[model samples]
Target chain A: MNRITLEQANAVIAGAFAKAREMALKPLGVAVLDAGGHLIAWQRQDGASTGRLQLAVGKASGALFLGISSRKIGDMAGERPTFLASLAPIAPGGVVPAAGGVIVVDANGHAIGAVGISGDLSDKDEACTLAGIAAAGLTAQA
Target chain B: MNRITLEQANAVIAGAFAKAREMALKPLGVAVLDAGGHLIAWQRQDGASTGRLQLAVGKASGALFLGISSRKIGDMAGERPTFLASLAPIAPGGVVPAAGGVIVVDANGHAIGAVGISGDLSDKDEACTLAGIAAAGLTAQA
Candidate 1:
């Protein structure tokens, strides 16, 4: 199994921040997690909320838990409110059930890691996450 | 119910890691908990992620919480997701509805302790847990 190295994790964070700056998005918190749902790296921009890291981790870890992007989880949440609500408690980092969480996949389409961003509109956060993955020369699971 | 001694707990961890090395499995985090759901011993192999210890403990403690293996909880989660999710917050250390947790039993069939492993596939982790128990001359609850 391919593991996301710390260097790649840091690169993902830098890339996400760069994208956030380009879009003038709110100061963001970003988290990178390995496939086991363990945090590999995290960063919170100045002025971001104190809970931003938690939210970021929740998004990323939740994506790993369900094997889907947080955007999809958001859609699922909309369709099955009760089911999504139940997942938050059981999930290690608590499920945010929102966009901004994206999975990074290897050549085999197996998830290697995930990236999550918070502190802006969910769509904007997701855009940064994608940009970050691209910056790291990794593929985002569609 | 008999209590698991510290010495036995250490043996369990050593034995589990031995089996893990033999099988060339990924780095692992193992936790042993007494019947009261309190930690007796814990070890996280080099290269394992930071949150691994928490996950290891969650699996064992969760088993004690429900009086069954975490594998059974995983199956229950599949059948009744809401029911399993509801138990997480109330349970100490949280509940990880996954395999890798096994209850240790005494000759009288009384619960003695539990072993939890993480940092690999659920089945592989559970296999190590069982091996650890056996190495300590304990039986896994059927």
Candidate 2:
């Protein structure tokens, strides 16, 4: 299995921050998780709020845990709020069915990891996350 | 002041896992914290218990918050049980006051971060945490 590497994680984080800067978004926190749902790398911009890190981690790991984009999960969560709420406790990182999370696919089309962005509009966060994965030469399931 | 980088944290984790493998210790969980006591990195080896991650985080944060090794905290806790019991609620990460947490120091003798290990004997966990810091060419205040 191809696990996400630290260099790749760094590239993703740098790309996300660059996009955030270009878009004039607030200071963002980004987290990357390996295929096994373990944290590969994470960062918080100097002025980012305290909870952004955990939010990013939760989003990314939620995506990884579900093997789908968190946007899709959000839609599902909307339809089944009670079930989703119950599911959070059983999930490793706990679920946050939101738009900022995307699954990263490797060359073989395997879900290799996930990238999550926080501290901006959900759509903008998703854009930055996808851009980061693309910047690392990977594809995003967003 | 030098802040602990993701690269250094990765090195430390890798070194700790390598030592754990070398020593044939049980599956372990390790966590790294920044100078401000925020989580920087963490991993639970395959088959490690669910609680190990939180345990590692608490121990590391406890050490960082107190500016001393968790082993020392444990000793103090033994003597001042009531004080240590009261301290946990005041600490952000909820102090563990046990072995397996060590502060990482920079060349100028400033505390940079901390490493905490769990899922092994407390003494062995402390040994691995110190070994990981040393392997990364960082000093462990153990």
Candidate 3:
């Protein structure tokens, strides 16, 4: 898989914010992480909810740790809240099992990194995050 | 150096955030960890200021490394910007080298974990963190 560089991470944030501004949505916070889930770049739009950053990291890290998009966690949670809750201890930090974060796959479809967004509705956050992945020319879905 | 458990870490955060809310402060972000500086758990209040969680992690982790308090760094930085800047990268989490966090310690004063709070002024952030540490029955330098 091609390494996701800081250049790409920065570009994703720039493009996403531009789109968010174009829409005049409330402030947004975005985060980009390496495949290992370490912070690569993050930004909080002026007046954006601060937790947006953590949400971004959590959702992105959750996807990366599980090697799947966060959206799938909800599907598997039918009667397994206890098992799902175990993930937080294993992963450290927090994990949100939903699709607000999208994996950034290399051209070969190998996982490389992820992008996450928060500060809007959950769906809006997911939309902005996908917009970022698309702007980076990466497939956001599994 | 005992490893910090996620449960212990979350306990600190839950307590701190509850107190912060009780005091009518703005929403907050809190992170806890152990001696190795690994993250245990983190939470960002819904309306917290942007970047509060990351800042809190950085502040708390930074204080842990120095065996002092983040307040000391903040005060010293006012007169020693270059020194603090040089120290920022020592932690990969973008430590601000300022006040607002404290290291969690063991009875023998061994560094264990840390908690950082953001979403208010630096002083208030520090106050909240102190409140959290106090809630944990651990001591902190104001």
Q: Per-residue lDDT of B1-142 in model 2, one digit per residue for the tens?
A: 4877666776788899889988999988888888888876666675676578678888898888888888999999989999889986799886787899998888777888889999889998988898889888888873
**Residue range A1-142, candidate 2, lDDT tens digits:** 4666666887888898888889999878888887777666666665566677778878888888888888888899989999789876699787778899998987687988898888888889988998898888777863
Instruction: List fnat, each candidate.
Output: 0.08, 0.09, 0.00
**Of the candidates numbered 2 and 3, which has the greater DockQ value?**
2
Docking class of 1: incorrect
* Model 2 misplaced stretches (Cα beyond 4 Å): A1-52, A61-68, A73-98, A102-142
Give one digit per residue, the lDDT tens place, for model 3 in B1-142: 3545434554576678777777788777777655555555555664454466568777877777776677887887899889878985676665666667787666677777777777777787777787777766665543
lDDT of 1 by residue, A32-80 (tens): 9988888899989889999898889888888876667889989978865
Interface RMSDs of the predictions, in order, are 6.0, 4.5, 13.2
Best candidate per lDDT, number?
Answer: 1
Number of the predicted model whose TM-score against the real structure is largest: 2
Clashing pairs in 1: none
Q: How well is candidate 1 docked (DockQ)?
A: 0.09
Flag clash pairs in model 2. none
lDDT (10s digit) by residue, model 1, range B1-142? 3878999999999999999999999779999998888888998876564456666777888888889998898777768877876775698676777789999988898898899998887899998999999898788999
- Go through the candidates in order and give each one's DockQ: 0.09, 0.18, 0.04
